[model samples]
Target: MRYAVIILALLILVVGGFAPPVVADAGADTAAGLAAPAAQTAQLGQDDSAQTTIVVNVHSDTNATWKVRTRHSLRSSEDVRAFERLVDELQRGEANSSLDEGMFRNYAELAAESTGREMEIVDVSYNGTVTDDGTTGVLTMSFTWTNFAERTDDGGLRVGDAFTTPDGGTWFPWLAEGQQLVIETPESHEVQNSFSGIREGSVVATGPMDLREQPIYVVYEATPGPEPPDPLSLELVAGVGAMLLLVVAGVLYLRQQEETVPQSDTGPASGSVVDRSPDDLDGDDPDSGDSDGGDDVDLSLLSDEERVEYLLEQRGGRMRQADIVKQTGWSDAKVSQLLSAMADEERVNKLRIGRENLISLPNESHRTNGDE
Candidate 1:
């Protein structure tokens, strides 16, 4: 089974185009010009000293809004350290993820690349200042997207110029694959989102503007062409196909074995055999456990790194510490203390990078790097 997994992984290497454990890789130098947070960082400042802030209370009151994998929160205080592990891996000679996902970094790295452009994050408070009542908080990020084809500062490609987009990426085929759709929030905000194009293409799409995805290479995607298929989707199809083939082969082998064996005309031995059910497989949880089939228990008591790793792994790869704070409303001091403890245990490595409360998930690189 392990060998089969290894082979499948080799196939993924031949296929899955991206790096991981949590990071933005090399070739991802100057996003726009900001210094990539050399170290993964998380900082908390009591912005409004006069007001008493309550740690946000997160409850699994509603399961519909709580998806185990699709939705994620900064699950552990140690995430920043895990994030640092990825940075060290990148600094070392591990170029796997960089080579794979290098193309997309040019855009995502802007937050890390703003070298000299007066970077500022103006957050919206819930005190009803921006609106009538304090029901929402807004996060506003303004920065330069380095390769802005037409630099107003330096003369190059300007407005009214079109760039060619690519077709379905690494995985999906027929569907638009990984296409970008333009979105302008109700508040007159503008942003771009990626689309799968299968259950999520244009014709089926019935809301707002449809902009092209953030291209791996800006020079091309801005224009008109085809979008790339999702890499994960492709891998899924590949994995499924491979698994199905293996199952078929196993079935045939079993048939061959049966034919070779002398017919003993085996009958049911003795008494009735018990068949187990799904819930029976994993023993029933204690009656007092959580209601979501017992999967999500109160994990707050777990140590920082343990909590973070468990949550991120449960999700795919990434998570923001801020998001976790928002969901759980944990205090900065507590969060920091727990994460520090994890660093001491070498379960995670903490580094100062990016802005406040930023974190990343762990990957193989984290295991080898000493926590700081």
Candidate 2:
């Protein structure tokens, strides 16, 4: 009986060894199934522990400076090691690393393609650091994005098209959970309108919300520039004073000229009187007949100021005062006084260029150095 029992035990042991090992394989399969979800959960937890902040500074030229900061909580040694590895990779400029310039360029290209505008990312830089207490890791990246905002016709800025997809959908994949986006305008600008965002002074903050369903849009206008300088007031005062001086000088000159001219008596002088027919006096007046009778005979009927203005009109609304004197056969002082008076009245503009003054009608443009 003992021999039979021993033989049966041997046979059972042999059968068990030759079996397909199904139980061991089943246990390994169950363990792998259980570990996979745990690993996935751990990764998701790590991702949730990260906080991201993006700051965009919009400039008046439509360019933007972008700064992205990501903070990772180092809850375990594994997280610390992973963060350090990522920092090393980024420092080495490895492809597919965290926040590399190429990835940003790709995002910018995508934005440009969706918005149908030119976009360029430049001056990309990045840094990674651990907290002093070794409890957190921080990653920072910055760049300048050209044409990030659109300039409106009314001298304002329109933002938010870059975050949209080609099909009018939001690019929410760019935003992660616990992420914040802050947009700032130039110091000289103020937010005029915001579609959906929190406004704090010139800054607009968004996120920690559902950006996928609701995108952000903002419009800002440049503040009015500084008022005209005090020198302009001084210039007005000086101009009034100069005009008064010109008027006084003109009156004194007319008085001096009148005193110089011999007064006419009731009887004509022996040499000045001549036999003249009525036809000779046709279209002639005591004030208009004094010219030497050429093309200027018609101009003689005009007042001194009118004659100067007519000469300027003939020369296409702009003439040098010296040219006016040469055209009207007037003295320099007389043309200057007339132009000064016309300028004071805003009928003409006198621009001083070098050693000469250019006279133009108020509607005419001032002459540049290249002009004659």
Candidate 3:
């Protein structure tokens, strides 16, 4: 019996030795399975704090064009390499493997380079180091693409639909901090229906999309604004002022010359000379032109001042002195002198508002159809 037992024990030991050693390395296998994914997660966390900024410029000319500029801030050399690989994968239409293999294939080109019957990429620029030296680095890229569209029709632009990194996460992933999208349009075009409702001229701005697996879309509709008025130039104003001054000076000089000329003493030509003093002349005295022969004056014969007075009566009895100069095409000095004379003669009242003068005809002065 002892010998039979010995033989059975030997048989058991032999079977044990021949069987596979599954239990011996089970712990090692489990640890290896857990360590790989954890290491990958740790590597991704290093570069998850980077930022991205994008600028889009839309031109709605004869052909609509779109210009896109993207800037990425990277942290380490591993992050830089990861981004480079991501870009390559996107170029080959190998991105977003869970979707159709080539789903994001054309996306990078749209922001980098693309050519087709409906759209064309006119220019592209990519700058930065492939690897950062253990510190933060920057990567910048830009591309301009064009699409055929009617110039007169309203134009629209869209950006930001896909947001993902290639290395699954061990690479440079987009961060939301400082992420902004700026859209600029033509001068006469106004951007409407923007995400943020913040716009200046034709430029529109919005904050970055939240960090998520889903894509974000930004669309803008542009329409023309009212045609701008012709700009007033300093040179034109100066030229008009100089011309008015010459005209006023010439008229004054001619009047002065006429007054200085001597008159003939002999007036009777029929054979008898009627003796008369200078005061007896028909129109020599200034008092003869007055209506009441008192301080009441008549401005009917003064053509320049009369024209200004007529303008004031037409413009609700009041107008700015600068406006008067513009309306009469006269110099500022000439308008000021005429307004001062009218004010002194009590024909018009002048009120000063800040640095400007407003002139109005007197209440007693009524518009008469006879001379105006």
Candidate 4:
């Protein structure tokens, strides 16, 4: 069964014009498989219950780590052993010539020629495992492909160009049914745009998809740098300093007036005493009590969620969750719960990038890298 699957894949490659010369001497079953359509051959070679997941992590240097894992339900020990044997053969470089590193190198060379860049495939490895209850078998393979992304003029990355054929035409590698491809962005970068597939924090394409008809292109750029110091903060500090200086100067002037005043020990006459309101003494000026500035929001009047929204607005409608906690002096758990609730309410957007949650106001976009 393993040989048949390998032969089927090789036949598909031959039909697609991407086969290596080492696979030219296929058996009669290969010819028989070739008689069917390439998609049908791929579908027939795999079990209906099997699933394949391909994760491509593109690094900042344009190198990519590819991890391909296939899981199949095993009805008996023979099925597990067959999977183990296939993994062993693939690990020892004795699987089919089409499944070896040379074929990948050939693909990389063609990609390099098409993109006008140097490309190398390295660190190829394989692993196989079975569930402890022996109900399922898993086969895993991984490799690193260097220069798999093209750097843009503005210091961003343009992936998917490396998958083009040397003739500048669309070329899609074979993907079986129940297969999925996940393209992760480099660290400290956020996806800017995606030409194909669903982009929800990361790029994902689920098969059976015809890449030849709809190709994948993803663009990501580094997160924006820290914002400059808030000018409002500086203005507040200056206002406080001016108020303090005025208070000090008034105190000194009052002291000088007391020292310069002549002593008057005469007691007030019995009916000369007058009652006065504080406002009357201060001279009722309408603007005297209006100390609230346009930038100042009375946080004491706001709820916890509103306070968070206010903080996000202060920081250009986006902030890290940790920064929110720090700015609001709230506990981590409290901030997390508040943000989660706000996100559920669609009042705020929370994007988990790496270990932190980037909080943004509704309708406000945040720059972020890959998310898990």
Candidate achieving the largest TM-score: 4
**Candidate 4 TM-score over all chains jointly:** 0.51
What is candidate 2's CA lDDT for residue 353?
65
Give the TM-scores of the predictions, in the order they appear: 0.18, 0.49, 0.32, 0.51
TM-score of 1: 0.18
TM-score of 3: 0.32
Error of 1 at 316 (Å): 3.1
Instruction: Predict model 3's lDDT versus the native.
Output: 0.43
Q: In candidate 1, what are the lDDT values of residues 225-255, reduced to their tens digit?
A: 3668899999999999999999999999987
Candidate 3 lDDT, 55-154, residue by residue in tens? 5565554233332223334455575565455455434544321111111123333322222224444454444444334344344445554542223234
What does candidate 2's lDDT look like per residue over 46-96, in tens digits? 445667677888888999998877776777667667666666666677523
- Give the C-alpha miss distance for residue 157 in model 1, angstroms: 99
Off by over 4 Å in 3: 1-46, 62-105, 108-117, 129-134, 148-178, 196-372
Descending-lDDT candidate ranking: 4, 2, 3, 1
Q: Which lDDT value does model 2 have at 244?
A: 100
Q: Which tens-of-lDDT digit does each residue in 1-372 have in candidate 4?
A: 433343355334323211112333354444344334433223223346767677889999999998766676777666666656666777888765233565567568767888999999999998878889988777677899999999899988889887776766544554546777899888878898885555666788876676667777899887877888899998999999999999999999987654333222111234554232342233433222334223555565667777777655544456678766656655688778878998899999887766777777765553333231
Score residue 276 of candidate 3 by CA lDDT. Answer: 26
> Which segments of model 4 are wrong by more than 4 Å?
1-46, 97-99, 173-176, 197-200, 227-372
**Which candidate gets the maximum lDDT versus the true structure?**
4
Q: What is the lDDT of residue 271 in candidate 2?
A: 58
